[model samples]
Target: MADDDLDPTPVPPRGRRRQARFELEFGDFEPAERGRRRRRGTRGTDDRSVTSSDELTYETADPLPAPRRPRDRDVIVEADDATYDSRLVDRDQRVRGRSRRARRADAPPADDVADEIEALERFEDAIETVRSPSDRGGGSDLGARVLVAIPAAIVAILLVAQGGWIFVVGIAAFGLIGVWELCRMFARTRPSLVASSAGVLAIIVSAALWGREGMTTALVASIPLIFLAVAISVPPGGMPGVAVTLLGVVWIGFALGHAVLLRDSDHGGGIVVNVLVGTFLGDTGAYLGGRLFGSHKLAPRISPNKTVEGLLIGIVTAVVATWFAGLYQDWLSGTDALLLGLAVAIAAPAGDLFESFLKRDAGTKDAGTLFGPHGGVLDRLDAAMFAIVAGFYVWLAMGGVS
Candidate 1:
């Protein structure tokens, strides 16, 4: 029976039998009591099927979103030989730039500083040129004047050394020239010739009576005589004339009378030579030193071209020359030589400054153009006159040649 039933089941087939089997299997699970159990069992299987299908879709079609290409910051770049070389060149350029900066920092700004210094030097040069005698067109006859003056000076020195009327005559001549120069200096003011002459005559007379017992008396008498003469010969100058006449008598007449007194001394020739040589050397040293190393002005208002360095060098040169003269002539011991040298050094510059003061007062660049480069008789004699007077007094005090 079992065999027949199994075989015939297919034969029963058709719609009615199939519907009957579906109802028989599903009808038990459709009841409210078993519905929850049926849903719970089916949900697990559905989730498994959905999960498997989604995994299959992802593997087959989606391609995993291309693994999300790494962001620029996270990316790693491998260097090639060309990249390495470029990096090295960049490093080398950076190093070169740093080196240039360092070198520039270490060096001074030479161009700017040099330009300023050069400009200052040029300015000083311009100032000097403006004040220099050569720039003022006054050195034209310097060479000729020096030529005549040197020989004439030597002759006068020789004549004075002979110690006779020659000295007296020379003194008289110097007094006359000095008086004439004074007159010329005040010519615009119409200085009295008679007063000037009387002053000069007083100098001559005082010199003539130098060794006589009445020398002081004659010198004292000359002043009143000069004043009287100025009063008598007052021209239009009035009191101005009298004042100038007295000034001439004291300045030229009295000052020059010392020269005659000095010549009358026992060792007059050596004293005169020493004073002259020392003063000349001092002047020469001043000129050379000023030209070579003049930076600071000695007297800016009075003598703009004169320099402190020049003045110092001149004094030192005068000291050296005087010292040498002392040694050669045996006129002074070493200590006395040094002392005399000091005196000459001090007095010479004073004389020069005094003459410069006079010229400034007179509104003149020089006393006169008589000796051209030497300026005038007063110019040549200024330092010598002061130096001789100082030297004579110093020697007398030291008991050297008096």
Candidate 2:
């Protein structure tokens, strides 16, 4: 063979070159299948020009699948605007898909769809109906409240009757539990519950043993311990966490500690009973009054359900209840009972609102669920904390206690 014959890129003749002898057998292949084969084989040879308008329907005999619309794109149409289409249009000037209303319009009316719409409407109505004024003060949870409150009240009375180290221990235990609940509320801040509980226990015990001075000393000393606790925390919250821990100890711990001091005083049982009766009766009156006749808000920003009418009713109820309770005890005068009731009335709501403020800031409905529907220990004692402190002062002013 010649070297020129072996060259792959040989020049064609000046005239027409002879074509190669090639044969393709189609056998039983259809016209479209043959056309597709030819097009694919001659892709870069320019044998066929595929235009944009050509629909390659022969790729498969089955029709093209419809584009899927996202389920979340279904818009909730208002009852009033049920007939209106809410389909959106993109920059491409094409409707995204059928909206909820549009689909409902196209489909024949069915019982299931109508039932779903009706159910949604009923759910909204149910929500509005349950939003009662008493929601702030137990509301539908009254049964649970009563069940829990009864035993708790009896125990508290017994503790007051038995005034000694036992009473001190009871108060200290309450302070510890309250502080724990408060610490849990500041969980994000990583405040130390153990350290805070210790601080609260110390404050309560010191108040019982060495009086106010000892309690004051413990409160001051606990600050360093709290700082150290937060310092070694896995994810420390720095100075802010320290402040939060101190708040829990002082607000809950110190407040309950005053109860110990009150119980140790002259005519302490009577004084303590007077404060409890007044505070609890006032709380109950507020709830009942608000449920029945609450229209004007007392503090809409702080506590929406509280009403001015309820507060007035509570004040009157507290005064009456305290005076009645005083009749049982010879040492507490009617006038002094009335004064104590007034003090409790003012302090209780203030304490409740203060806790509400804290809960609102913490973005929680309740501090904890220790007392079932009544909420945590803090929730049950919020008003009592302030009431006990006020009662202590009132008793001191009357020279009943040293």
Candidate 3:
């Protein structure tokens, strides 16, 4: 017999009593909902029926739900695509004002929200600038380069012509500025700009006053001062700071001294002019040639733009330009001109590469921006520094100087 039949006057089960109480309290507000609940209760009772053996069993067995299929990669991907498409459709509908009220429900106040949006926009712009290429030192303007170079060339010529304390002072000024730039480049080493500048000035002045001997003396003497300065000012990374300090002194200071020595030599003005012509012309030639016909890299590791073709063209241009410049100076013979041209040509590129190496190590595109569109003082004179030194040695070898 059914359980309901057995419980005819059995004081109604607890569940039936509770259902009756709920119905009495709420009355029949919704007859359809009440009928649905009654059907569900009947089904549940059938699920827990008892057989003649007093063992509970389902009156009509309902098979267990079919086991869910394990999802493969393709099925998961398809589901994700479907979800994304649905989201896109929903967004489109919202933009068309189908859910304007719903969308505005959790939004912040208008003024506060506007300010937050503006702040976010500014932050994104700042981050974009920070993410810009680090090697973007802009000195590529040709007109600006020429404008700066012309005045600079005139000043250099005037200084070279006035060989004395004026020239020495000029060289000292260059050394000081170069020291400051180097200190800046390696600022993390905490190199003292004053100390390095003093050392460089001493080296240049001594070269002018006492030639090679005084220059050597000053270099040896300045080492102690540099050491003391590094210890006093830049206490950390002592060795690196000292090394960088000495590097500026030797590299820039010593090289510029050779320019003084060159000027002191006999017929120095014409010779200096010839060297400048060769060095600058060679540089210009290399630039043009590389732009026109650069196929193979000259030094891919040190400088990406340098090319073998450009180097050859520069050598040829230097030789021709030097020979042409030497025509005005009767003392410079064919052999001497050739030798000086080749030396300057080779040494100029070496100096340029050396500076490039330094910049690469320092992670900078230019040493400094003092020259505006031409780059730093070092950038402009890097090749000239080596070329001048090379010309001096050639002059000494040829017995142009007593």
Candidate 4:
């Protein structure tokens, strides 16, 4: 046989060549069903052999199952402000979903909702009860009252300027008014006639004997007598009555009497003026500061509206006003003035808080409406009364006028 005709090295067939090429380019490519087909075919024919061409045909014939069509439930519906279906989502499921979303979104917890609701309700209640300054007649009444008070204050100052009976009368009248306000406040809780009368008498006697040598002795003697009177007159179960009466005598009577004593001191008029101005400035500063920058509560239980920022402003203004008053009147040295200012700063807030405590206990907003926007005499005098008593003691301790 000719060498060309009878070729010893045979070339691969077209299908074999293609299979070899495919194996080289895409190694080990086999259809998933190839093994299953072989197994099925071999079950009947034990000697069946799987061919590469069969595997290749199977790999080429099979296509991935048609891309899955998403079901209605699988599709997420997203809308800007779309309302949910009420029939699809019941109340419980809706609430649960909302709570879950809130938690996932880092929102406030469900428990805080009740607290916020309560706070808002309280705010609404407060708004209903306390009218704004503008709403309450545009402050015209306040202005008119101020005009009236200015003259009255000037006259009192003039009376205090004179020695003897004039000062006594002025002090007695002021103390009596304060006593009346206090008695009126406690009237529903107790019979305040005896307490009011006793308080006025004590104030009169204290003022009358203020400058005398035996004044302290008389003042000391009156306390027991006042207590005894209240104790006897007040019913057995009427401790509040006795307490109010005693409180009136001590607070409205003796505490206010110190103002008279302050007036009788060497630079008495200046001392009284300094205290009054300082306290007024403190109150004004607190009001403005609270209105402007108040955030943190000072005493939420006693006075929810009071703020720490306002208290700080009040203290600073009080100190500055007091120091200026001292310098103006030449009543105290710079250092002594500063000390008195500090005292006033501390005592003024204390007095205001004290009255707030009383009013809160008595279930009223103001002690009276005599001063219009200023509330009542008690409301206006609360801080001053405390400041005066504190200033008098400080004066005595510092051995009177520096």
The residue pairs in collision within model 2 are none
Candidate 1: count the clashes: 0
lDDT of 3 by residue, 1-402 (tens): 334534221121247678577545544222211111111134544544332433222222233466875533222234533332223433354446534643687866656765887666546433532343343354343445567878878888988889888888887887777778888888766676777788778877787778889889988998988888887882443566778888888899889888888888898877888888898889889977876787898986567778899999998998889988887777789888888889989999999999988876775667878887457889888999999999999999999876
Best by TM-score: 2
TM-score of 1: 0.61
TM-score of every model? 0.61, 0.66, 0.64, 0.62
Tens-digit lDDT track for model 4 on 1-402?
223432232222358778787555545344434322222133654544433434322333332455976553342344411222212233345668777867766667777765886677558435733566667656543355567568757775687678567877766776667777787787644535554555556665656574433445555665566556645763421445556766777777666677777887878777787888788788778867876798898998788888999999999999999998888765479887878888888999999999998987776778887766456778878888899889988888888833
Candidate 2 C-alpha lDDT tens digits along 1-402: 233332232222232222121111111111242211111124565444333333222221343466977453354355432222222222112232334444665564456656876566545433633556476464454555578889889989999999898888888777777877787776766778877888888898898889999989999999889989988987554555777788988887778788988988998887888899998889889878876787888886566667899988988888899889999888778898889889999999899889988886665668888777568888888999999999999889999779
Task: Give candidate 2 misplaced runs (Cα > 4 Å).
Answer: 1-141
Ranking by TM-score: 2, 3, 4, 1
Q: Which ten-residue region of model 2 has the weakest summed lDDT?
A: 19-28
| lDDT by residue (tens digit), candidate 1, 1-402 | 123322111211248768467445433112122111111123543422111221111011222233765542332243532222223444455667666765796654556655876566546544744464565466523344457668867876786778667776777677677777767776544556666666566665666564433445655666666567655652443344555566666666655666677777767777777777788788778867886888999876566677999999999999899889889866457777767777878888888887777765565666766665456777877777788778878877977544
Query: Deviation in angstroms for 259 in model 4?
Result: 1.0
Q: Measured by TM-score, how close is model 3 to the native structure?
A: 0.64
Q: Tell me which of candidates 3 and 4 scores higher on lDDT.
A: 3
Poorly placed runs, candidate 3 (over 4 Å): 1-142
C-alpha lDDT of candidate 4 relative to the true structure: 0.68
Q: Rate the local accuracy (lDDT) of all candidates.
A: 0.64, 0.74, 0.74, 0.68
